[model samples]
Target: MKKMSLLKVDKLTVQFGGIKALTAIDFEMEEKEILAIIGPNGAGKTTLFNCVSGVYHPTSGEILFDGESLLGLSPEPVATQVIPRDRHAEFFCSLGMIAGTAERIAVNLRLFQRTEVSELFEPFGKGQKGSSAMPHKRNPILAENITGLARTVRSYVSPALEDMVLWHERDISHSSVERMIAPDATSLCEFLLYRLAKVIAGVEVDEARIRANMEITQGLVFSEAVLLALVRSGQPRQKAYEAVQRCAMAARSGQGTFFDLLSRDPLISELLPPRELDQLFDLNHHLRHVPTILDRVLHKE
Candidate 1:
């Protein structure tokens, strides 16, 4: 069987007014295959690359990336602006939950950096191997420390909230809790935030492992897209829902890939052909909308 091309550019042509930059360029690349194009000045190298990147549209022919057309994605330039910060009065009672987000992230890092699992991060300092006994081990001990500190900060939150419910304005219990927790939570939060910054700054990212982990779900992530597409194809909502659920269950039970099972289903095969089915299972398809979302966030419209 011939290997499928991850990227295919056929009969590509580009022109700027009457000057032709490129003509009749054709190429096919397999997944994980690297190909370098070398050329001197005015050889249309950048133009060809730009065409594939969706920066410049081809005057003729087609460009397909991972089975999806890379056409009509040229983005408009978004203006840049500064975000100003403001000082606000404290609601120290709720500080636990806010600082708890850091705790949540630290907990994740603590788990994900385990040896056999994603194993994608090591938030250790320079010359630190993260382990004293195992030379190859790099544990998230810093994140673990941060987690303990965040827990201490949160321990004071209950007292603070209970103090809010007290009847007297000058309750001795409330005043005592304030005098103790005020400095403790504030100082601990400041220290945790600083240590978290340091740990993150010293983090070592394993990009290859991250990419391999992206496929750990066995294409199950695209099931929602398939479900919606089936509903759009005139199938009843419950019918589509049940069909998709069955396929997903089969995939989990080690039958086959999610896409293979969905495409082989009689009802889904008739509604969504192989081409549309291939498009639905793409990760980059979801990522292509990120720029537009960032535009909205920046413009705040």
Candidate 2:
């Protein structure tokens, strides 16, 4: 038995002024079969789909379904037969803006997390504390507030996804959902950006605390430097890695400082002397290229 195509488009053409959006496009779909049309931007892909789906009338075409001409038919049937999908460009665009704002806020929040309030530009108000019972407490309340609000903004995406499953020709299911989520999501994102800007502008960075925290690891953070130094000093990579790993683990478990362990190790001492080891642990050695990286990022050169 021979089966006939369920839907067919033959010699479809579309033109807008002098622009021929689609030309001589032809395709067919059988029952329970899927078809995909792919093309670069502005290459008439949307035009062909629109014409076949009844969103746009083609200049010359024959669209048939079940052996009947579908040309010049009302759009309501076509729209119902084919699924109606919302592009939601505006909602997605707002989401992107919100994500970017949230990312910036997260960076600022992390800065506050790593710093002490005493080192802030302006410390907490007189007698202000995080807990009612503890008078010496200080919290990053502003950053926490932004984090909470960002969660609310992110949650709106769920309802947006739910809105995609509407009944034929579109229904009122997504209407109320959009009405609630769109304004709330956009406004919340704007509020977060504004509040984040204010927080960042007023927050003071504690350089002293930053420096102290950087040294809290007792030089274990420089294990990579030691490994590279060993490699550069003609030690086999596996041997150097095992040597650095032992030191790092010992330092992490409060056994000894990384510098002391490496300096005492016979293998490491043979290649890198005390002076060379000292040079490797220097913070400036790691941050020496920061200025160049900053210039490239900020100056875009």
Candidate 3:
């Protein structure tokens, strides 16, 4: 027996007027997995997606989905964007009811104020009002403007409805809109899943990057440990507080470390030596009762 990937794209290529969009691209995705395609602008991210989703037949190469070739099949059938009014709205509302009812019973109380809850059902609003001084203003900061643009590009439904009323040049009336949606939606869907796959896998965090971020935090990372140690020692609370503050300032200025500042302070040096102070910052410190916690959680007494 052999394991196989759910989707494999091999040597996919696309060209427009000698401008090579994708050249010899190869990638694969396994079952129950997500993938992401990322690249800089003009790097064929969308073009490759179009090829995979059946929108643009690759100038060359093979696309295998579930071990079957998807080439030549219309991408339109593969992706359908809809705002199914009755069915979709009913389904979403029903889901909300189920979740809402469960939550209400769990809390044994009515949650949220009446006015606050009404906002979700309000009619969708659009546009921004410009200043009264400018009557010709047409501000474009509309709610869901991006969403509307996305819908227009990949999920528009109005053209099909409007076409039903068309008489002559009826074919041209709908053909233009269909052409855009068919390829655009298909490519967008492909790009979406490709991008999602990378997220699911968790982009590899370069150890170098993590180390760089850690450096920026400076010695402030040890603040809690220092604060707790000050509380634990027999020193009066206010005096210990001021000493730690001075140490932090010196550390931030790159003058000395937290321990160095503490060492110079005659009071702390006499009371707490270096060896004991080291214990406070040790990384291995844990919650002390791991087994007891796990036993309660897993029900394995």
Candidate 4:
């Protein structure tokens, strides 16, 4: 009995318009054996892979699997078996998701920094003028940079998804796309992660501004709390919901503060006294469970 080679590439050469990308490369792999091709950038590793996977028509050479010629076969079979394993799509998709999430966070941070108070994030750099002509400008350029980088990272998702549906068993269509996206997307995501960390670490949060913004809704944010309180106080669920909705709508349309609207509603005042109603509007009521949630999330309790 003899061990058989699972894959073999002999005398492989690939050329691109008179430029030889791969020159007489030879390699073999046995079943269940791992092989790594180590080289610096532009050392033809990708070209060699293309030749072996039938993405590029080799100038000369042969590829064999278990002694059968792979030259005339569709690229899918070879590419699927030798190049991209089952986890390739999952791995890249995860990176795209991370990039997208980071992008969203950066966008939100930028928006917060631009709001009227403009105190969510401290002005970038001491005396760092946002505009030369204006002489009184501060910008969220770091967040903007993350946003731009995320665009490039997100663009790679389509190709990765398309690569998941190669023709028959494999096709060269995804080859060029993968070659560009795989490295670029992962690299962009890496940069985004680091950039976000730096931004978050250096960011100066305005607790007062956060509290001020939370109050902008003018007690309407506590509508859910009021509703829950009404229900817990033995009010019919639908009645409680309707009462909360009416008050919320009035407050939202600038009729009055939600507390005032609810306080004046005869149906609500009968169920809860003014003091209890005021307690329902307290921000602490909504945040009472924050510590528990944080503990669960951080695995601390």
TM-score of each: 0.61, 0.61, 0.31, 0.65
- Tens-place lDDT per residue, model 1, 18-79, is 99999999999997799998889999999999898777899998999888889887454531
Candidate 1, TM-score vs. the true structure? 0.61
Instruction: Between candidates 1 and 4, name the one with more favorable TM-score.
Output: 4
The lDDT per prediction is 0.80, 0.78, 0.57, 0.83
Please report the TM-score between candidate 4 and the true structure: 0.65
**Order of the predicted models by lDDT, top scorer first:** 4, 1, 2, 3
Model 4 segments beyond 4 Å from truth? Answer: 1-86, 117-119, 165-173, 248-256
Residues 1-301, candidate 2: write the lDDT tens digits. Answer: 7666899899989989998998888898998789988878999888887887778998997899988887887655435543454456446556855765776666566555643423443234566676688655567666666777787887788777777787665678878887898888888888877777777677777788777766788887889999999999999999999999988888889988889999888899899999999999898899999999989998995
- Please report the candidate that would top lDDT against the real structure: 4
- The residue pairs that clash in candidate 1, if any, are none
TM-score winner: 4
Q: What residue runs in model 2 are displaced by over 4 Å at the alpha carbon?
A: 1-86, 93-97, 100-133, 249-256, 296-301
Q: Is candidate 3 or candidate 4 better by lDDT?
A: 4
What lDDT, from 0 to 1, does candidate 1 have? 0.80
- TM-score of structure candidate 2: 0.61
lDDT of 1 at 164: 52
lDDT for position 251 in model 1: 91
Regions more than 4 Å wrong, model 3: 1-200, 216-218, 284-301
Sort by TM-score, best first: what order? 4, 1, 2, 3
Q: Which window of 10 residues has the lowest lDDT sum in candidate 4?
A: 78-87
